[model samples]
Target chain A: MPKLLEISKPFIVLVEGKDDAEMLYSLTHSMGMPKDEFQVLQYGGKQKFPSFLKQITNFPEFEMVTKLAIFRDADENSQSAFQSIEHHLKSSDLIPQDSVPTHSGEVKKSDSGFAVGIYITPDCSNKGALETLLLDSLTSEMKSEIETYVTQAEKSLSTDRARDKYKNSTKSRTYAYSALFENASFHDTFNKRLWDWSHPTFNQLKTFLQAF
Target chain B: MPLVQSVHFSNYRNFTDFTMDGLQRINLIVGDSNVGKTGLLEGLVTLWGNEEQFKALPNTFRMSYGDYTTSLDSFWSWLHPQRNHSLTMILRSTDIDNLMRAVRYEDHVRYDRDSVERSLQKTPYKINILPIGIGNYEFQVDLFNQLANTKNGKESLVSSLQVIEPRLKGLDYLKLPSSNHAMVYADVDLDYKIPTTQFGHGFTRSMEMLSNLILSGSDIMIADEIENGIHYSALGSVWKAIIDYAVKNDVQVFATTHSRECIAAAHEAMSEQENYELNVIRLQNRKGEVVAINHNKEDIETAFDLGLPLR
Candidate 1:
């Protein structure tokens, strides 16, 4: 759902990877935002944020861009992720180079309506990833059932080497939930609208999308 | 350190008030077609060259795809925005003291000063333009003749040729009685001295360009579509020769390319050098103005790793 090479829209939303981009594509659409209002692009990984930021600013369409949104996972530290985006944003040749917003769901607008913003997943302040947000969106009964299935699946493994992959992995838990629906892919779960897009857990992320 | 630290162009072929600073010794310009790649090279040659060069090479430096209008009196006439013919084109670089300004009147071009000309004459370097097909075979023979006059120039040519063809034993210029004209030949350790052109386009292309860099004794070498004739397998070797010769002689080289392999080869070649002095300058046409985006060594390496749309 997310475009890779060219940026046809005036407003760009940079995601961490392809799955994030594809998920945000339907998420933003479900949030009542106009389809042509923005474009979501993947930078492959968070370590390449500076390189991607430096390169996109050189595009001819960048001059016409009025807003930039960075969506990366919190992973370990949310503040650090936000700071990384802020550092590269200031270094870029974006119009009205200024400070980025420090808090999530807040937008800093330039005098020319050219603003740059950031939103770290999952829940903006948590030390987790997009899968954490997806897992929280499930109903209480469904969440417990999926967690038990993932725990027992880890016990069935032959060795701790194979079991280590499931330990502290919200990704494996999310995949287990998606596996219930005909073995859909990571993005297919997002594309097929299998997840509860209108869940209250997405309120902060929805608010962040409104800033662009 | 860069020789020409910065350059500002005022009304030079649709590039109105564009400044490209942070120039390195070796720069590769890339962009969409007709975005002033060749114009940047030509503008530099005119800004740093003398009146003799302008008279002798008015249209030779242009790319084959540029708008070649015969109605214009000379290349200088088109330097003006919309060809008004009344404005003076001013080119300023950090290395030179005076601004090189020129105006075209009724039939010819006029300059106010020749400081850049005198400065070039005093130095041991000049400007050489190598467009696609550099020159004819006879022209290559002439270059070989010039380079042979100096010490080790002949051996250098043979060894550099060995980069693409290891069997090459020697290079010579001969005008045999049976031949219609004089030309250059290669000794590929075969039975007879094979004509260089008889080898292949890649070999002849590499021979002409590698020799031109050494034989012309140019301080600045401008090439267009550097990967035109050479094959993909030999791109790395050709790039090594260009980088080595350019660094050894402190020559400022500007080459344009549309091939990713060419860009990678140039980047790879510079990586082996002691110091990294390569920059990829991409010109983008926004609205009506030409904008330049310079990617240094780190940026280029990132582009390669991420598959960025740098070209």
Candidate 2:
């Protein structure tokens, strides 16, 4: 386990959709990363952001989280939810007013070394810009099939939207999109071709950590 | 299988007769207010609890028509003081699944002198409810030991509770709180703790169904209105636990509820469970006699359309 001097590797509280949490944990563990290193909490859906926050605050480990990340879909209410958290924290004097990020993907650090980030993106591009870019290159027939399938699965789309907004990263969205499409017929279609644009997000995550 | 699957007798207060027939893994009894939802459970309690236990109405508190009826009046029967009851449970042999193959009531014969100088004696009623052969047989133990013998050892009853727990292997320790003496196996042990007094109305009524089901090893146990006071969120888990345990122990259960959550939980359980047969009985009152409307896949949609709440 990587340690920051006497400081433990910060607990990255990832409160995302249920399937997203499951996939994240699975992906993390598959890469030899211990699940316990970052508590991957499931939010069920973005409708429960307030309750999720309240529940997480109740847990004893809430204060120990050196990095508090809010990953949700950029639904109609995502901006309000992000602002709610920032407002609540600012009012509570937990985070400096200036430190609260104004836009998605922008990192803001608190006085106590605690950091917060927001991920808000369009629903269609939830698999991130890269995966969406890859999907863009697909045949019109394939695009229509994906859209039609997604349109029918509106419930799953809402959940995917919440996740996309939370991670605030097109890269994470691409991962999610991959997961969603992994079982679909399009997986083989883009299986070999999409890596050029999509592989770098995970590689960037590794690089970012190594540099830090 | 129960010939009369569910019975709802009210207005007479203590003279409720809620019985059912041909019980399955999951049975739903639906009826209007005062139609004997709780009354049905009372009958099962009486049948499973034992004749002696039922006779000593003072000792064994009974719930009738969704309300606890503690004081015994000449409501059930005037001829027999013992039969002045609220409910009676008649179960089919096949529904039992040979889990508790034999259940023989202990002899309860006591002589008492009436004010008229007439000698009154308690008669021992012996009936083998289980089949002649099959099932993991154990000694037919009296749950209400005191009813049989005033000086019945508490340890003996406690030992019986312990004896029954291991036979039902799927029981998780987390779900069941343990006893100091032993794990309570019989219906008596489970009901002993249920605060059935009118004072503990909420506690009494809430746990009454679960308490009776656990204590009485009746294969086809019936309970009306499962989520009385328990939160709807918690009711799902409680029902799941009970259903899971029942399915594993080969116990068929019939529970009626007006709450949509309870119906949803039962429906969800049915969808997940393939082996269980879930039948919803909607009682239609015509004049004075009540007729049950059973819903199956063929007419479930129609039944739902008729406001039967078939989930």
* Kept native contacts, fraction for each prediction: 0.35, 0.00
TM-score of the A chain in model 2:
0.52
Q: Give one digit per residue, the lDDT tens place, for model 2 in B111-210.
A: 1212111212322212112111111112122222222343333332233223223222121111144534322232333433321122122222222333
Give model 2's TM-score versus the native structure. Answer: 0.33
Docking class of 1: acceptable
Q: Compared with the true structure, what per-residue lDDT tens digits does model 1 show for residues B146-194? A: 8899888888878777766789899888776768977777777778787
lDDT for B239 in candidate 1 is 80
Strongest candidate by TM-score: 1
Which runs in model 2 stand beyond 4 Å of their true positions? A1-212, B1-22, B45-49, B56-74, B78-220, B297-311
Candidate 1: what lDDT?
A: 0.76
